[model samples]
Target: MIVHSFPPIIDSGCRMLVLGSMPGAASLQAHRYYWNPRNYMWRILYALFGDGREPDEAYEERLAFALRSGVALWDTIASCERKGSLDSEIRQAIPNDIPGLLADYPNVRAIVCNGSKSLAELTKHFGDHPEVRSRELIRMPSTSPIPTRDYRGLEDRLEVWKKLLEL
Candidate 1:
């Protein structure tokens, strides 16, 4: 059984919040989000940063970049039991304390869930609070490697993500 031992580290100054459904095994093992290889989040973010640098093992640096750019990171589910890293296997869903987090951080102007699953979970709990809903609700493709071919390539996805910076 996988446990969410800690809340996701988010920047208080973030104007945008990017949420994944849950961390993969790699991420859990690493004690960090988006730690899996072939997960395009790092690549996509690096493109947005305009350094043309590939994502190295330095996750703190990447996270720092996001924070510096006014973006926050987290997942919708606080915890779940899963037989595997597959998002579909997630059961006994427990919603994270998102509203509380948002209340604490005043700068978040938009929320972008990474996939449909996350959107469903958020909507189920929040019940169309436009203050949270109106902030951006884009249907971003998942960065997980388990499901294939759902996402645009790194560069293309980064183009879409760039809008967060504009907001």
Candidate 2:
């Protein structure tokens, strides 16, 4: 199946850009980023930036909160063929115009890749671009529900992701 990424949830004030590989099945079905309840992206963001409360259920509210927090969201892959939500399944990936976006939004000081795939794709496609090299590039653990030996729980992942607060 061919899946496409959403438009960037970005603004002029954004200082941080979070890039995922692409929207997964649940997110695509719901027309939102990290729509899967088990996904820790929202939870981690709220834990770090919110007032010690659960993230708002409304996607609009979440986007607003992220923007207000000086963060933006997007995907490394503009479109790809994938059998499932796993990044490993992706093929024929066409990258988004990351350099163009960065050129337009110069305020962004850091680029956070949500997982290995996102980082790999970004490096493959845009590593040499001046816009990308100018900013701090970060590779974060995937916020997907799937567990890994290193990041098997929210607390574990949250600890590593807390570095975003420092940026």
Candidate 3:
């Protein structure tokens, strides 16, 4: 089935752009990013910022915190055909116009990919785009509940994500 991406959550003050490969079925259905209960993205964000608000708060609070923290959420694939919510099953992916996004948000100091799929998509298309290459690019583990041998646990992933918050 074809999956469409959400419009980015960004503002003029955004200094970090967080990119995912695509929204999962749960996120799309909820019309919210990282809505899965098992997903660690929200937990990771709260830990990084010490936001005080619980991770499982209302969607509006999460969105407000991200915007206030100068972090923008978006996805690398504008649209794609994917089975279920697995990034591995994505096909016919159309890349988002990231260069244009960079131009539009001049304060962005870093571009952080939420997982391998998003990193590959960005590198394949915009790796050499002057504006893209100019920013600090980082690749972090996916926040999906699926276990990966490399990441021992949420702690392991948070260690990597801690550096993202500092950037």
Best by lDDT: 2
Ranked by lDDT, top first:
2, 3, 1
TM-score between model 1 and native:
0.87
Candidate 3: stretches off by over 4 Å? 51-53
What does candidate 1's lDDT look like per residue over 12-37, in tens digits? 77887888888888888998878878
Q: Candidate 2's residue-wise lDDT over 4-44, tens digit each?
A: 99999999999999999999999998889999999999999
By the TM-score metric, which is better: model 1 or model 3?
A: 3
Candidate 2 TM-score, true structure as reference: 0.98
Where does candidate 2 clash, by residue pair? none
Query: Which number leads on TM-score?
Result: 2
Please give the CA lDDT of all the candidate structures.
Answer: 0.75, 0.94, 0.90
Cα shift from native, residue 1, model 1 (Å): 2.1
What's every prediction's RMSD, in angstroms?
2.2, 0.7, 1.2
Residue 48, model 3: Cα distance from true site in angstroms: 0.5
Candidate 3: tens digits of C-alpha lDDT, residues 29-104:
9989999888888888888875545674789888888888888999999999998999989999999999999999
- Provide the lowest-lDDT 10-residue window in model 3: 48-57
> Candidate 1: minimum summed lDDT over ten consecutive residues — where?
144-153
